[model samples]
Target: MGWLIFVWALTACTENPVDHDIRPPTTLEGEWLVTAINDEPLTTANGQAGSWLGFSAGAEVVRWEPGCAQLMFLYTVDSDDFRADAIRYNVPYDKPIFVPSKFMPPPCAIGWPPRLEEAMEAMSLARKIELTQSGSVLLSGEGRSITVRPR
Candidate 1:
C-alpha cells in the first residue's frame, strides 16, 4: 500500500517541465559564419516596393577557418536570447560601413531594441524563440525575420 502511494506521488511530482528544447549556449557560443540570407520582400501602401538602388543583398559572409575563407561569416555570440540573440562581429568596424549611398541618415541600424521604439512595439507580438536549430536560429516579429547561422 505504501509503495503504491509513493509511486503515485512520485509520478504526480514528475510532470515534465515546460519544453526548454532550445538548448543553452554552450554549443553556439564561439564564432558563427553566415552562409546565406533570405531577404523578404517589403510591401508599401501601393504594392511591392522596389529598391532605389535597384539591387538587394542580405547578411555579409565572413571567413571562418584560417587562410581559407568561404561563403561563411564568423562572429562571436556575445549574448544569446532564444527569442532575440546578438552576435558581435569578429572584425571591429564602424556602423557607417553598412549605410547605403541612397539613404541620407541610413535606413536602419543593427542590434536589438533597434534604433526605433515603434518597431519594437510592433515586434512585441511575435513568439519569443520557441526553438533553435543547430546551425540556424530565427527571430520573427512584426512580419520581419532575422536568421542567424553558424560559422
Candidate 2:
C-alpha cells in the first residue's frame, strides 16, 4: 500500500518535467567563426550565397581563417538575444586583404550584419537564439538564419 502511494507521488512529481537544455556562456569572448549562414558556407572558396536564397552576385566571402582574412565578426549576447558585428581587423601582409570596393553589394548580401557605425544601428534590433534538439543554436530574425558553431 505504501509502495503504491510512493509510486503515485513520484509519477505526479514528474507531471511537469523541467527542461535543462540551453545555458548561457561562461566566456563568450573571442571571435566565433560564422561557420554557416542560413545554409551557405562561409568558406574561402565559393563565397556566394546558396542558389535557393536568390541573392545577386558580387557576394563576397569573408574568411576568419589564417591565410585569407576578410572580416572578423564580434558577437554579444544580452539575455537570450545576441548580435554579431563586423570589425575590419588589419590583416598581416602575408594574408589576402579585403578591400571594400564602392561598386560591390553591401556585406549584408552575404549575411554579415554591417560595419561598426552601421552595425551599431543594426545591432539595436536584438535577435533571440533558439536551441534545437540536436544541440545546434539557431540565431534567426529579419529574414536571416545563421547556425553558429562556437570555435
Q: Which predicted model would earn the best TM-score? A: 2
Local accuracy of candidate 1 as per-residue lDDT tens digits, 16-96: 222356553432343533221222332334665421111111232232222121113222222343232112333334332
Clash pairs, candidate 2, are: none
lDDT leader: 2
In model 1, which regions exceed 4 Å deviation?
A: 1-20, 24-28, 35-97, 100-127, 130-134
TM, every model: 0.26, 0.39
Poorest 10 consecutive residues by lDDT, candidate 1: 50-59
Q: State each candidate's clash count.
A: 7, 0
Q: What TM-score should be assigned to candidate 2?
A: 0.39
**Would you list the clashing residue pairs of candidate 1?**
32-151, 33-73, 33-150, 33-151, 34-73, 62-72, 62-73
